[model samples]
Target: MTTTAPLPDAAPANWVDRYAPAWSRPWLRLGRFDRPTGIWLLMLPGWQGIALAGAMAGRAPDWKLLVEFFVGAALMRAAGCAYNDIVDRDFDAKVARTAGRPIPAGQIKVWQAWAFVALCCLISLGVLLTMGPLAIGLGAGSLALVAAYPFMKRITWWPQAWLGLTFNWGALLGFAAATGVIEAPALLLYAGGIFWTLGYDTIYAIQDLEDDALAGVKSSARRLGAGAPRAVAMFYAVAVALALAAAWTADLSLFFTPGLALYATLLWLQARRVKIDQPRLALVLFKSNTWAGLILFVGLAAGAGRV
Candidate 1:
């Protein structure tokens, strides 16, 4: 049977709800497959890292590596979401938006959720095994970040910051996969992607402010309060600066700047529109970052070749 309705946070008429089989819909939602933006946000930094590495060496991006990273990102993101849901099931019940998630709604049991997470991770590890040792080590190292992320909202006002680190780990991993060693350009790119995640996720948190307040969940959004829009602008500015720094460090073609400019403009638009009261707009702005990230990827790839 079709699921009763889409989760509140999911997009209108999302494909997961519309197209996925009845038995699979709950599992998919448990993994947040209904909201593919998270997958893009998780995946893009890795792509950028691969592209940046390729650009630095004056070579085209490895299509095989790109495909591998995408698959890994999808699986790992699913695993992370399931794990988070299992841990936060109670808190999720108290939050209106999340109360309907598979775990919280009793669509899936805790042990089952754990199994889903493990299945995703196992497949993701299989993908990781195909890469070089440095990338493999980097991939393994990311689990620590992922393991710690679910509890961040309970302990810190800046869970988004932790997520920034977690979501962008792929940058380092991807760079390692391509070059067999970490480099200054990839580090800079990773740092820049952190700030970019910060900005976009801060916007994402706008959807949960009131629910979070009642549940005592701390977040950068709750911490920033009225300062959120300004803070997002500042974070986005830092992101753009760091990205440019990475390109310069890599000695990529000047063509990188144009894409970077467009990337900056998209972030600016998001920062411009965010108002604490406009949760709907916030969701739209948050999802737009996927496109922004892709634009940066294309730009970075196109900018390949030493000037």
Candidate 2:
């Protein structure tokens, strides 16, 4: 029997299972609404962009912009998840960890999944249109990356790096939306966010290393093998350095330094403690990046205030 129980990666009592109507459960599952970490991770870069732009302006980020990005992020992330599931339905069926997904478990049909993707993207487009011309153009351009991301794992060993590009596109868009122009700091933040994704997504991929190998999937975790923790540390180090450079370029005050320090420490702890063999431990460490992102946002906002 196909169980409606929470999937392995989702929290035991996630809202999708707890509150979503039975008829809507499959659609919600397709979007990963139950696993909110992905949503946070995807949204943080945009938040950072807005915060960084606020620092550049020596003012606070616009609350309306935050609300817009928040709604937009959730919609786009849901679209991305549905599209990925559509593309990977066969592969998902073969993997133990993903076999229970709605599509693989026969809870949702492929045509229905595609229709859901279209609906989510259409809604997200309305939010995207609220931004300035530059941001609107950049937001539209990101669709190509989103469309191509699902095939990256099949074609390259470094699909995580591709994810870094696709996921961090919002950093650029947010900056453009806030400032009406892309500047050096936004570029730096975009670059830094790529490395950040590299580090965290590598950690996330650790949970699937065994299954990915059996399924012939490629990932940084499988590429780095047992050296993943050290490599993650290196990636985090580069990310911190680039972020500091972004702060410097934006003229954010020294107050940003301490937050950077704390952010670095968190990444260090994750790198030092994560066990490639322990999928649960890997997941815990992966989720910790939300705090890291928040610390950076606070640093940027405070630094801007003092400046």
Pick by TM-score: which candidate is best?
1
Model 1 earns a TM-score of 0.98
Name the weakest run of 10 consecutive residues (lDDT summed) in model 1: 1-10
Those runs of model 1 whose alpha carbons end farther than 4 Å from true positions after fitting are: none
Model 2 vs. true fold: TM: 0.97
Candidate 1 residue pairs in clash (backbone atoms < 3 Å): none
Error of 2 at 79 (Å): 0.5
Q: Write the per-residue lDDT of candidate 2 for residues 1-307, one digit (tens) a residue.
A: 2448789989898898888888887788888888988888888888889999998778888778888888888889999998998899889988878999888899988898889999998999999888899999999999999999999999998999999999999899988999899999999999999999999999999989878988999999999988999999999999999999999989998878888899889989998998789999998899889899889878777778672
Summarize candidate 1's per-residue lDDT along 1-307 as a digit string, tens digits.
3466888879878998788888999998988889999999999999999999898888888899999999999999999999998889989999999998988888899999999999999999999999999999999999999999999999999999999999999889989999999999999999999999999999999999999999999999999999999999999999999999998888889888889999999999999999988998999999999999999999899888555
TM values, all candidates: 0.98, 0.97
- Top candidate on lDDT is 1
The Cα RMSD of model 1 versus the native structure comes to 1.0
- Tell how far residue 161 is off in model 1, in angstroms: 0.3
